[model samples]
Target chain A: MQEKNANQVRSRNEIFAERTSTKIYLEQASDDNPYIASAAVCHGYGVNEVMAKKSFADVFYLLFRGELPTPDEVQILQQLMIALINPGPRHPATRAAMNAGIGKTDPAHILPIGAALLGGEHQGGGIVDEAMRFLRKQQTTDAATSAAAHLESSTPIPGFGAYYGGIDILANKHAAQLAQLPGAGKALQWGMQMSRALEAQGVGWLMPGVAAAVLSDLGFQPRAGVCLYQLMGAPGVVAHGLEVANKPITAMPFVADEQYFIER
Target chain B: MPEKTFSDQQIIDSLNARRGKIISKTGGWFPGKGVFSHGYSMMDDLVGKKSYFQIVILNATGKMASAEFAHWVEVGYSCLSWPDPRIWCNQIGALAGGVRTSAIAATAMGVLATDSRTYGVYPLKEGVQFIQAALVNHQQGLSAEQIVASVPSRGGKPLIVGYIRPIAKGDERIRAMASIAEGYGFPMGPHLALAMAIERVLQEKYDEGMNVNGYVSAVMADHGFSPDEVYQIFTTLVASGVTACYLDTYHQPLDSFLPLRCDDIEYQGTAKRAVPTAE
Candidate 1:
């Protein structure tokens, strides 16, 4: 037998919003795909038209930034995406995903754990975004004063100094590649100088800050660039997750062993 | 292996012992470690092998949807995927974009917005339940009029409450969808035929046309979906257009889509009230 009546079922669904207004789904005047659309047209370029002619990099830029990137910008972004894609499984989020996978959890469930961790304030692209934001602010000033002021501040400057303090060769290599882009603005110039100064003080440049500088100069907002970090870092984590999930469940230590019961 | 026999009630009791998020054990053994579905291997057998629309219906109903039904679902999605970013649920996409968030965030928010009673998938659930109740009453040999009359007592409108309203004319989307379904040439089935009778009664009494939700619900009933299945399946389909709205407006300024200022609103309450001073 069915458990609930119509009203009884409907009553359970009420959300109890504090304020009420007629909800809007679409603007009548500006944006609507009327009737049947057999083919998708993006920014006046049809799918077939773009597919037969343009590269995916062009469409990706169009979707993300609302305009196709310059050829150089596309190349830069593509290279940056490749360069920053993974930082190995030792990253905390990847480690968490692998642990979840060890319990034979589905990769569908395990992959999201890494994605969520990447969105945090320190891991993934959060540090990269913070680095770009700080660099963008320091663009007007020269290296010495900007470095002195930021270094003296108590708040952690995420990009300039590594947590464990070592020069990141991967970040430095890609940073040089991206630094050559035609529209190297004040942000990139200031970012390089600050990295140099911070290095002298025993703090080294991490890949996130360098990547953030390249993305900022190419006209990405901090958060948007951070999304790329989240995207790039996913595969490595998922790979580790799949590897771990492939293991026998009996191999891992039980959670009961780790739990500490305190006597009151 | 030894053969065993169990009573019908005993089998039902065991199948429903654990009710978890993934329906892991209830109804069927769902070994979710790999491509766990109701019974089928979702990953190896279905993914990349079937059309996405087919996958949706297959997973939702545990079988391939009729070609005619699939066409209606496609049509229903096309009409609802109206690209306006300002609608109740579509606004979740717009709001996500305005905050400099990703399309994924907008998609998540868009799904949340549909968890509503007034405008969300909940209305579909209500509409389905209303029809189910009438179906029960009809199966018990009650007249259509008796079933319709009994609906008000159970928190259902004699005519289904809906998303779009026309003051004088019928909704064009409804007309288009009905025509599209007619083109399919499949029978509307018993449950859907009952819904159509209810619509006819409603139009005769109140001169109102079937709204999108009502029309879709009727069509869904024809597909042999239960109320819960209708609601869940509906959630998965509509987000196609909502996600598009987010991507379309990802780089636009906040004020670009729907503009409103404080001056646009009117105040009706008392002008001002002073808080009582602390002693």
Candidate 2:
């Protein structure tokens, strides 16, 4: 005989919020319709006022951080935004977008397709959280000791590691430039020392490492770093994708029969 | 190049060997001839002859399941196909439909949403692993009470993944599935026996019971299915539910699915202030 299921199906009655809440934005109802928003306030300032008074970086920071940035913070953030505007044409996320575009897939899907691929662990947003956390934890310690410990363990230090058998020269250069800014904080400074420590090991800054240091110094949470990395890299992915959107499928190389191998 | 401290020539060599070449052990199509999958000719042997569930299992696990097992798996899909938009994955479909997105996009997004660790397909892997490990422990002479005690607890209740459900206290789906299994004359396997024992201990001690994830994980483990295989098999478990939700909202007036007023959102942000000019 099948045993009767004695438990009754009942809701746990988890108390969800009565109204959806946000500390980020507030919308005022229009005079005519309660559903229509007449004005929007981000943090505290009116959206229109912000547009007139502040730069995009200040607005972006205010949206996330709940306060306007300092002059140094705004300048560093604006420069970082420019630095991370694209992940370049060779990146897998950008390549995925290009593939979709060239294949004549729906233009709407180019960003989504590429963004999804960018969520991967290698050279993507997946490691940004780790990089941020690593920076936070290691900034209190001696960077040279931490770098040596990680090297001895044969693990790529989260954020600091070798790229293609050598240090990433461009990433190194970017870090150096960002470090010179007045806004560079403890995390960024520690990452610079860590970079120097890793120089002999052929390990240094990768893009995520550089971004993670800046974001950590700027006070973004570790988890937010993941999506921020993806969001910042999205423009380049979309641009590169649209670049080849009108090209024929044959525009990309197709492996010849001789080049195709069946391992089994 | 900076003085090389790391030699990755071996790695580069391996990558170069496979450059511009496609190598596959799984079967692919030959344009002029036929399509192949797991060594079976798709058109000749599978299409009309085999059930879709059988093909799904074959493609997932590389082994063709019996028609009976396939039917059982198909029935399992029905257990999760609840069309209520209140469910998380289904709500994604509703939101997509409300925005007038394409059906394919809506369905795909809904399916993707089910990759969540808390309630959906990904949790099944942990569920299966827990039950399988518990059985091994049972064989090593640990009692059901011992197994229950071993798992970390919160508020004096065991925090096992498969046993406890999110929304409800006990699972109704388990009974529905058990009735079908009995009708099929499927023998009670050791893994399930241990699972029931653990559930008995849990229910008696903490008033908690086994969920559907627990039941399915144990049953699949008994049938020689690995955790990965089970996860792969049920990857689209909520697709039909998601589609039903999408269609429900898609046919309705736009932005009418639980429409919110401007005051519906409670603002907890900073007080109104002036924006400072950027230096």
Candidate 3:
């Protein structure tokens, strides 16, 4: 059993290593592009289109429960959402922001400002908007079916692909996963149709970037998306952080200005 | 009939040889970084002069093999420190040993200290302020029990666990992880099967039955999970399942409906009942 466990761990480690290697290579290959830094910020934060669609529900599950949910678990989530819907603003930070501003302000800006103050630099409005959009879209049509149809019809889908790049395997996988959930048959059906549509149109390959652009146009500010992505990407960040939590960062020696003066 | 060469206690003692240097280095939880460590130091500076307490630093740095892994451990440790008070020192090379050894030392010292204020510090390089607050509370000898008593149940922050499935489709490592997850009673495959099954049922229910929420609850309840775990389990299970099969629409017809099963329920069930059941 120990040996088997060890092997399993080893295999996981290898997969992670391979994933990291590919990412690093991509980073290195794209280092010369000025947009890479900005793109990196988005990618690092997990704000791209793919993550926007699926990770929220996944994250919600992990946060509330210790492990992943089953299909039944997904239903309970829907119920919980229903229960919590219209509970009114409960966040203290938002309340504090609202209270701090004594002067009467426009409700539109005031609400967003209050939300922004409460959310701070880490919250991404774009990610939230995208998530809401995907949720709303899925609510009306089968998510997979719609997604597939969107892909096929060459119609812009919100959260099915990556932003600023090619198709995101992660998002695709996540969407596919979501499609499999109880009642996601329609979504799956749509996704299939979309995929076929995209292939026929020869634009399936470019859908992610287009989807991202559409999301951007739909009021998902890139910076807000980035912040939301960071929050969503917390797990990966934590994983990386734990690796060196105990070890001392090798301090780089600093040379005094006087030394340079003396040499001169 | 073998000669009694050694007593059972003696044999046990021999096997339990004294392990070397238990507390090797301070972890982020105790003193390395964040507001907890900062607050701890501030409080220590303020009260250590007058308070009767021993500030021992519990370190878990030596056990960390990589820079990234160390950072993650530090972050987790920092996050866990919020509910307790312990002074976390931020000095490097102050303590030593593996995670287990350091944890044992901290527990021992924590239990033995006379003053409730006795604390430990574990710092990280880039600790967040929220984490620091937790560490400060820990150093001040605050316990989860005390925090719970003082704060409302719903007011406390929820604990967060982050994970990533970075493996590509068709990777042997992915397959291996799946297999291992299954072996470890993870229910990755079963969960996917169940989700697919539930989705079909939900679709049918929507056509012939109640509201979305009702159908969802019924489906989830059938699988023995409270509604809360459904979304998360579905997310992971579906991701893993799709990735495992590499079922790109191009490769397969993608038209067939997959059946789900109850056996794939791999998750922590609701808290166990308080009473014992008859055999």
DockQ by candidate, in order: 0.01, 0.57, 0.01
Q: What are the per-residue Cα lDDT tens digits for candidate 3 across B1-279?
A: 111212245445544542221221221222343212222443444234422211211111111123332232223233222212212221100121111223223232332221112222211111122223333464587543342233322223222111011121111232333343344453333323332333333223221111122222232233344323333222211122222122222143332222112222222233321212212
Comparing 2 and 3 on TM-score, the stronger one: 2
Candidate 2 structure quality by residue, lDDT tens digits, B63-123? 8988878888888899999899999999999988899887777887888888888888888
Q: Rank the candidates by TM-score, best first.
A: 2, 1, 3
lDDT per residue for candidate 1 within A1-264, as digits (tens), equals: 111111111212334434333221111222343332345445445556667766776677655665557767787777777776666776788878878799766455666677767766664677777878888877777877767887798456667564333455556556666777764556666766776676655554566776788778878788887877787777777887777787887765543311322221
C-alpha-based local distance difference test score of model 1: 0.63
Off by over 4 Å in 2: A1-4, B1-7, B277-279
- CA-lDDT, candidates in order: 0.63, 0.86, 0.30
TM for candidate 3 is 0.21
How should the candidates be ordered by DockQ, best one leading? 2, 1, 3
Report the lDDT tens digits of candidate 3 across residue range A21-69. Answer: 1111112113455323333112122224324444455435433332334
User: Compared with the true structure, what per-residue lDDT tens digits does model 1 show for residues B65-183?
Assistant: 65567667778777777667756678778776676666765776687677776775778887777777777788899866666566543233454554224232345566678788778
Question: Model 2: what is its DockQ?
Answer: 0.57
Alpha-carbon runs more than 4 Å astray in model 3: A1-71, A75-125, A134-156, A162-164, A183-192, A199-232, A246-264, B1-279
Best by TM-score: 2
What local lDDT does model 2 show for residue B277?
51
